[model samples]
Target: MTEPDPPPAGVAQALYDRRDGRLALEVVDAPAAELARPHRTNYFTAYWVRAGRGTFHADGTRHPFAAPCLLFLTPYQAARLDPDDHLHVTAVRFHANFLCVETHHHEVGCNGVLFNDPYGPPAVTLDESTEREVADLVARMRAELDTAGLAQAELLLSYLKILLVRATRLKRGQQGTAGGGVRLPPPLPELRELVERHYRRLHAPADYADLLHATPKALGRLVKQHLGKTLTELIRERVLNHAKWELLHTLKPVKEVAREVGFDDELYFSRLFRKATGMSPTGFRAFETDVRGGSNLSMPSARPSIPPPPPTGQNADRPASDPPEPGA
Candidate 1:
């Protein structure tokens, strides 16, 4: 596979703010044009494409998007825009310290639906009416960011919450229609919740089956049919996602990260990580740091011009060694 182009030389590292270290929010009316190239950011990003037609490449998948849609990207996800026509885009970026999606998931329900659902598209197509609603929210957010006042962050966050909630509803409605209005089985939804809660300790499909009061065979079949992935693959992907986040955003050692993710053997963890991400833990951290031109905590004055390493084998999003599900 071809490697992605590095950020242009002398490009400043993207940060929430250099003045107030505590503030972790930024609203860009027109972000850097180089975003059309493959690049990853250290913060959560939402691209409000007011007018555009393009293919959004994220984590090795190409999603075709059009005007008046919202594209969501999690931190450290590889992304690029290939516009078929001139694109007018506004970017909103925020660090996890500013607003933790998991903490606010109960209110907005965007933790999985908008930001981190591995099985779903990363872009939300908006109808004309919903587009107007989102555009109003973005305008208000921009206005709030420009002004300095008390509870500004709170107000901005409230607006963000509303935007997320609306997008989540739209995305769910679209998904329901696409799936012919077939709702997931009870066990499938429960399985997602169980995996999110217990993935660290419980690594097997049978473990989740026991918790959901279903046979592993049945649950695995359902997952494969609906989600196009095996149960083991789902668990491993979640584990690797956490591992990648820790690797990118924190200075934790690989051994510590491995143990935190329920692997007692650091070497085994490294092997699995390499199999899934095309880089060992240390290498992934070092390479991503170099690509971003600084550690997550520090800002770089200029980005270095260095090409990224190509994939070792298969796409990192799909591990080659994912075991087949029971009775597959």
Candidate 2:
């Protein structure tokens, strides 16, 4: 099956398109360490704190947001903010049609990739000056709604666009310094599909590049630019996670499990396992039973991280440049 196209560029129409006629933003007081179950919502959210500090765990990394900071989570990104004490928060949430104007549309537009990944870090942070600027804008936005006019919704939409543009601009500025506009190669859809189907086996960079008719460097760069990982790193992690899984379940012995997971010699398998994880196969199993109930496993259905490594020379564990934080 093909992946669905991301939503098009329009706020009000998109809101009407996603959830008809209900646009709202609120300032609520809440405690620290708030947890959220994995879920999807139909509104954009901007959470800015005047003071306080906490770490936001999204995707797989932790973004530590201190005072005078802002975090944008696209409508579909999954996250839970562990707010700090005395959290002075401003949140702006609205439906799609609200951002129908062409200018606002570009901020959210990008093949929907910006909105899709939650585990990535935030795009940018507001310094003291920008914080005051945005905070005042949000305050005015919060106010004008009470004194409704024919253009009340229109005015609110304008503020929303301003805020999004400012934030996106800040992100673009930061990205410009590090690097910017490193486009992913074509054939991503086919490449992704191939990864999805055969991640458990295909690890060699060339195997993937060969299948997709791209160069290994190009594929590596694509993964880094889009997914925040090199092709080899992705493949290795996937294989490692699966090795952990089969190690804890089924009747496969250490050597067989190694072979089953793309490792041939049991001794070499032990070395790779130690490299990926800080434990030996037998030691991991022992720890699992001793620690978490029986299996050192997530579930039979736990998917591999990516695809298995190409069975040779694929370890540059941490990519020098991972993808920028989601919603960037």
Candidate 3:
């Protein structure tokens, strides 16, 4: 897999890279040009817009939001932000390995609900109060990162979990899955995580069932019941999504892209790609390249070129909070 690009100039530098790169975090206040362009990342990102009005596109859907909302993207998910000048976003990004929902299933409860869901909308619109709460948490994270002292990683993990928990509640409510006493389906979360981790390698329901310690028949039933798709379909969808991202964002050959997503036979991969996406791989690449104005994708550096801190003095005024009226 290609290394993740570093966070852009506006965000804070990574707090730390743990387990040799399983976890990291940054805050972004990127420029208008960068925000308008389409890009893909190999990490889970929670983009909180404190002030802005725009649409955030993920996977093929456009999620529109004013300020005080959170937009989500799982690893390899394609995204683009088109916002007005009032855009002031705080983006928190991390890899799945950093807080693997599979491992911390009970603590965060975000695996299938927030990051891995293929069918639900991607952004969670926060109320004014919720937005402030999340923004406060992010500010705390920024302060903690700057200190870079003892147990900072542990503290950051705790803060991250809190953010996810809050977002999960909002997401569930938005999707009509919220209730006082409702519980998530037992196997659905793990199943989604497994597919995310192994989709390129394991293409069958039985393959996942074996790892989940359940029979293929039982697992298939649970997946279809809760997720509304057969296990094989979910796997194929993920593979195709990643394939499309690679095709659009990178200059790799069709065969190389196919191999990247686990298909060895280029012809077979092309056939499947055409069937699922309604376009041949080469056609998709050409269309996307033209649409993107021929910007070549590259690995974003992990080390951001942080801009100098703003001057500190009595003359410094606080930034404005209200986003402009829709078209204003």
- By summed lDDT, which 10 consecutive residues of candidate 3 come out lowest? 10-19
RMSD, every candidate, angstroms: 15.9, 20.3, 16.4
Q: What's the CA error at residue 250 for candidate 1, in Å?
A: 12
- Better candidate number, 2 or 3, judged by TM-score: 3
The TM-scores, one per candidate, come to 0.61, 0.45, 0.53
Judged by lDDT, which candidate is best?
Answer: 1
Candidate 2 residue-wise lDDT, 107-192, digit = tens: 55421222332213364567778888897778778787766777887677667667766776676554422123454346665676
- Residue 269 shift from truth in candidate 1, angstroms: 3.9
In model 3, pairs of residues that clash are: 5-300, 5-301, 6-300, 6-301, 6-302, 11-27
C-alpha displacement of 72 in model 2, angstroms?
Answer: 1.2
lDDT of 2 at 188: 62
Kindly state the number of residue pairs that clash in model 1.
0
lDDT of 2: 0.55
lDDT of 1 by residue, 1-328 (tens): 1122333343323433323444567777654367676666656788888887887876555567788889898765667788888888888788765676754668889887888776566678877899899889888988888886789988999998888889889888766322344766666767877888998889998999989888999988977666656788779878888888787667788899999989999999998876554456776676555544452433242543344444463454544445434663
Say which prediction, candidate 1 or candidate 3, comes out ahead on lDDT. 1
